[model samples]
Target: MRIPTVLLLACIPATAFAQQAQPETGSEWEVSSGVEYESGDYGTGTGTDIEILSVPSRLGMTIGRVQMIAAIPYHRIEGPSDVIPGNVLGLPLLPQPQPEADSVTRNGWGDLELGATYALPVKAVNFSLSGSIKLPTAENDLGTGETDYTIGAEVSKAISDKIIPFASFSYTLPGSPEGISLQDRYAVTGGMATWLGRKTQLSASYRYGENPDAAVTDDQRVQLGLNQWVGSGLSIGVYGSAGLSKGAPDQSVGLRIGFALD
Candidate 1:
């Protein structure tokens, strides 16, 4: 459900199966770690600049047609308390609004995210169904202090040897915390990935989503990514994003490395 980010990179390979035979029946494990940084005003009229630095680690397992992932991220946030990381929602009910010139900084582990996706048994194209949950295991004041859930569908096709196009749709139900009312969120993403060679890939994508609060504007963004497989089931990647709406961060960048084993 990570709309034009790491999730998109993960989907590209899944969709590539459209041009080949079914995946072999076996279990594979992967571990990934990355650092992501974002900066933006996030439509906060108070001119409070928000900055977030995150270091995330993920463990994944693929068995037959299903994939499961678990993620934990450490976050350092500096900005107004009303603005939270991850989804970039602006809440008016958060207590203690600092002066425009003053900002508070907090660093701790954020919520734990668990997800699973199943590939449908079809050959015409690659299709999948996925679900994820956000557990309220964050440190105090580091998260919404409530659990969240998301369900989604994705489709993709490998029309040529080098080009793959994909799309995803998702809906999220956020938990309401004390003194705050959150609305449902919906998101859609479309993108294409091109293989430059056996070991290199380039991708571009766009995403649009609704904010969890009706009073806030929607979110829109464009992203570009590059991935390179060095060898022996090890890979590295980098990505950058530009937000087109006030509800999102102005800019963000990330770098990730992953290794897989059968």
Candidate 2:
């Protein structure tokens, strides 16, 4: 499948989300939002797919260490269609994900995710557990939506005074006829953050999740980035991701900017 930015991010969070977890839920009203654009080839052979571009924004809050998260993503894809010319085209030509056809082209919002998490105290480090629901908000006809929602949990552990390692897992329900045949969504991640000098902070991590399909599949991903404090409650960073699995994309890249407010 070939498409635009936002629409791609709107697909299954498990399939297109970052290697590290997106803290979308909590209690203290910790609001964070940003835009991202990426492109990748999803599979290989006749099944090889692609999402030309995708952009997604997110916001979340933390109350005494518990957080709630919510986000919306949009995407545009181009590939094959359901016609002869479409046969020449492929996935992104028909405007939607179809049963069997000559080609399919699509562009739209993928899915909505709403979830909550709690941080457990452990020495100088913080451990968190969370659960979320993946709302059916995309053009299932295109790529994502067959599932109604999902449930998830994550853990954060500190390795050193400034470095941390974390892991997570989640489950996705099946979809209706309007969405992708999302089987289950889950991932495990290890991450770290270090103070390079003063206002400069770097974060990096690796992630793995099951492919959202009717069959059993898995995906591996790596992420790296930096965070710098600009002023009072403003900061920015650049990030990128790469996929290492047969069930997932071959390559992906993007960036993010964030602002913290009270």
Among these predictions, the greatest TM-score belongs to 1
Local lDDT at 84 for model 1: 55
Sliding window of 10 residues with minimal summed lDDT for model 1: 1-10
lDDT of 1 by residue, 1-262 (tens): 1111233334243453334335557877878888888887666555787888988888888777778888888988888755456632222223333547467888889888898878898878888888889888888477788888988888888878888888888888888888666788898888888889877778888888887767657779887888877778677888888999987779889988888776
Clashing pairs in 1: none
RMSD to the hidden true structure, all candidates: 3.8, 8.4
Candidate 2: clashing residue pairs, number: 65
Candidate-wise lDDT, in order:
0.72, 0.47
lDDT of 2 by residue, 1-262 (tens): 1111111121212212221233333423333345444443334234435445556566765454455667665666554532111000011222233433243456767566676656555444344555656555566344333334555555545455565455555555544443223344555666665657556656667777655543533667777766565665555656666767554445555555545444
Off by over 4 Å in 1: 1-21, 87-101
Candidate 2 off by > 4 Å: 1-33, 47-49, 81-105, 139-147, 176-182, 214-217
